[model samples]
Target chain A: MQLRLETKQLNYSIDGFDILKGISINVEDKKMVGIIGPNGSGKTTLLKHIYRALPSEYKKVFIDGRDIENYTHKQSARKLTVVRQENSSDFDFTVEKMVLLGRAPYRRSFESYTKEDMQFADDALNAIGMEAYRYRSFNTLSGGEKQRVLIARSLAQQADIFVLDEPTNHLDVHYQWSIMALIRRLNTTVLGVYHNLNLAAQFCDELYVLCSGHVVASGTPKEVLTPKLMAEVFGVEADIMQLKNGRLQLVINEAMTAQ
Target chain B: MIKNRVATPNGYGDIDKSNISSVKKHRYIASFILLPFLYVLSVFLACAFGSSTVPIEKVILVLKQELFGIVSEIITPSDIYIVWNLRFPRALLALAAGGGLAVAGAAMQSVTKNVMADPYVLGISSGALAFVSIGFMIGGVMLNTKWFLPLMAFGGALFALLMVFAVGGFSNTSSPARLVLSGLAVSITLNAVGQYGIYNAKNISSSNAVVSWMMGSLGGSRWADVWIPILSSLLGTAFFLLNARSFDLMTLGDETAISLGVNTRHLKRLAFIVVAMMCGVSVASCGIIGLVGFMVPHIVRFITGTEHRRVFPLSFLVGGIFLVCMDILARIILAPNELPIGILTALCGGPYFVWLLRKNKGRG
Candidate 1:
């Protein structure tokens, strides 16, 4: 099955301050689309609308040609999953137990987990290489390990589209790549927000460059990660290159000269 | 750690029907025999081991007669009255109160996502005390009448809960920290009002009775005073049991609950009402028994590993048993003249809460 996500001129405001202003973008089927922006550029606010975390006013956000808001929260959860930036819980929970909670959207109230649900959870744990840490308290895990577990939880949700907000923020290099590699292998449509231009350029099939709550550029990674766009939005001079596999690579040349 | 790793089962490929059957059998055995057996034993020990002069044999005999109408000729009438009428109902009240408080604590912790949360954190008890004190101002000796104290106390608790909700929800949407802070502020204020009423009256009877009530007592409880708390605790505990899955999801916070097909807004409102009502009833009858609700849930979590299905129900049972025993201590510690059960609970609960907080402070 193919899934396409379209955001049509979305606008959002909080406490009379505009967070997302008339922004629009389309995510094609089976493509890894990266949203690159500096902090507070409204990338997260835009992503939140796609997951129905915030209400959008200007137009519609459609998933597979249907209005996302028309679907109930459960129906939307069944189709799309999210991996937000890590925020620890005040209450402690076991890793296995936390992962199993991902199956919640599929079950009914008062229904216990079935064999199939356990199997699905086990498979997810195995996929993330966190099987041995199943019984460990989730709070005891390192930042990188917690991020991987969160991804595993998303996998257990078994959704078609993934909207991740800075998923690699706290991870080590090895875990960062491993998580990206897993996401790539899923072969599903992924829309992710990232601050790491190199990682996004290397992994994303298409890229949306956001600046001050607007889509400044949208195209192939090589086209979007140019020195000009970098200087304009991020206030840095960056070199963009193509590798042997025709994939884009970005290297920050220098910080922009003052004045 | 090595043993733990090795203990984890690898693959289902080698599994057969027999292994699966054995696992199921072990589960059944655990649920049917081990847990319940342990629970019953805990309850009996809790019931029998008070600081009083009564022997276990006499207590058991009285209990038997009460439960099944099987009279033992050896036990005397005063002992029977002490065991069956006075101590038994009081113990049962402590049990119900303890269990109710613990479950309420667990529920409050879950909904608010606060590890230190308890039933009294909402200020229901303090509010109830304020109303009970009001009863004293009007009736002098009449406040000692059974119905007036509990009725006014419950009314006060309900009023406090409503006030807390209003304060928390006044400006922005209600958040846990805001709710808890508001509840604390309201509790302190209501308590001041109650104390002022007592100070103004300054009558020996009303003031001393209020002070004793604040200390928390389950002594002097008769069957007449038993039914309301019993029914309220039963209904409240049952309500929590039914929402076990929701409580589990809620501890993860609202965003997770919403994604899990729970209408968190609705679930939160429902939980608030249930917890408030339970705490209100408990405080009204027991006169501000402290610590059971806070300590028992945390202790249960340490043992059961924070799965609400096990933690919630087991907490109620364990809390009930603990309170009964504590009540027994309160009665017999000074003999004839009683200590308030609340004093012992606060003494126990206060330190335990500090220890838990210190232990987990940096870990989270």
Candidate 2:
């Protein structure tokens, strides 16, 4: 029973300033959809509305064709998991302990994790190549390591949909590839905010290009990643090329001159 | 250009699970035994060392004599009365105050996600004392009553905290800044009200007693008054222990917690209520002890890690022991003229806090 994520005519405003207006997006079960936008494009805000972090009107967002408001937070969380942008904290806990907290949604308030829960956490860490760092302090990890651990923690939830926002931010190129590969291999329905268009084109089955709080373009990356769309949406004169391996690479020629 | 992945899933590694589990288990066991042992020893030492200075051996005999009704002529009746009536109840009340405040502090830190937050930061003590001032103004010189002032003060504490919540909370959840500002506003207003109530009470002696009470004291700990703090701490501890997992979730911030199926607003609300109730009860019992609520929990987290399960209970024990020792110093420092326990804790905790900030300043 794979869940499909859909939003229709969603509008969000803060203090009379609109953040998102009439944004609609849909991703089929087990597919990956990427949201690519420049700063203040409302990509993260749209993700928040889908995940129930920020409230939206009833029936505006749906999972599995049912209104998202129909599901309780617990039910929605069990179906969807999120990897947020920031996970840094001064407080220290072991990597295993940090991952084990993913079971929080499944356990009762007074309940402790079971052996099976531990096994799931172990597997999640293993999937992220962090099994060796299980006992390591989470706060001491590099940015990439912390992001991987956070993804592992999200994996421990075993939800049907994974929502991520700029998961590769601050990571070196190697970690960025590995983390994206890990998420791709999971084969779950993913709705993510991606800052890198090359990675978005490479991994996402579909793309939604947001500019100025609106979805300016939405379709297959080949259909949407035109030179004109790049100039209009990103204000960058781009040299978008396809490699022998059939992956797209986007290179910025320069910022547009005033003329 | 496509590149080979830097780190692929190794499937499953042979985890040295036993080492981590054993290390964690050992620390937990050590903390459980060590904290209680320290608390009991401190209680005994604190109960025995005073103006008359009952010996440890006599303190044990007095306990045996009084608790089991084993009449022993080897110990003087005056010593028994001092331990049974004066020091034992005082020590217990100190334990209650320290333990409750520490646990509440731990909860508040996680709840607010601010390491600098204290038990009384939300104006619970100020609000409680403000309400009790009504009793003082109306009845001249009634500080020594058994339960009236505490009950009234508890009411005031709840009212003040609720007002803070109302002011700061939006929709469901509250920001730490809003809560702190609301608390500061409410605290100033309540303190003004209390001052006005006390100064206009028409009796000089009553004014003096009210002034001392506002400064906070453990001198009035009677067996009758002990039950409120004891039961309040016990109940509050139970509530906190149940929500210990939620507390840890919340410290990850509201978005993370909410994503994990935790209703962060509800968690914040629960935190405000439980912390306010625990602090309200403790302040009502011992006027207003300051340092333990902020210091003990901070130290406990430094020792035992950030998990609230250990942080809450360990802080309770550590806090109780700390306050008991502080009270002992209060009694022996000036001998007959005892400084208020709050003054001693502030004097001691102030320096420690300064060092903590200096040490952690580099991290900032």
Instruction: Compare the candidates by TM-score and give the number of the best one.
Output: 2
lDDT of 1: 0.75
- The best candidate in terms of lDDT: 2
* Alpha carbon deviation, residue A199, candidate 2 (Å): 1.7
Give the interface RMSD of candidate 2: 6.5
In candidate 1, which residue pairs clash? B95-B320
Chain A TM per candidate, in order of listing: 0.94, 0.96
TM-score of each predicted structure versus truth:
0.84, 0.88
Which candidate gets the maximum DockQ versus the true structure? 2
**DockQ, structure candidate 2:** 0.34
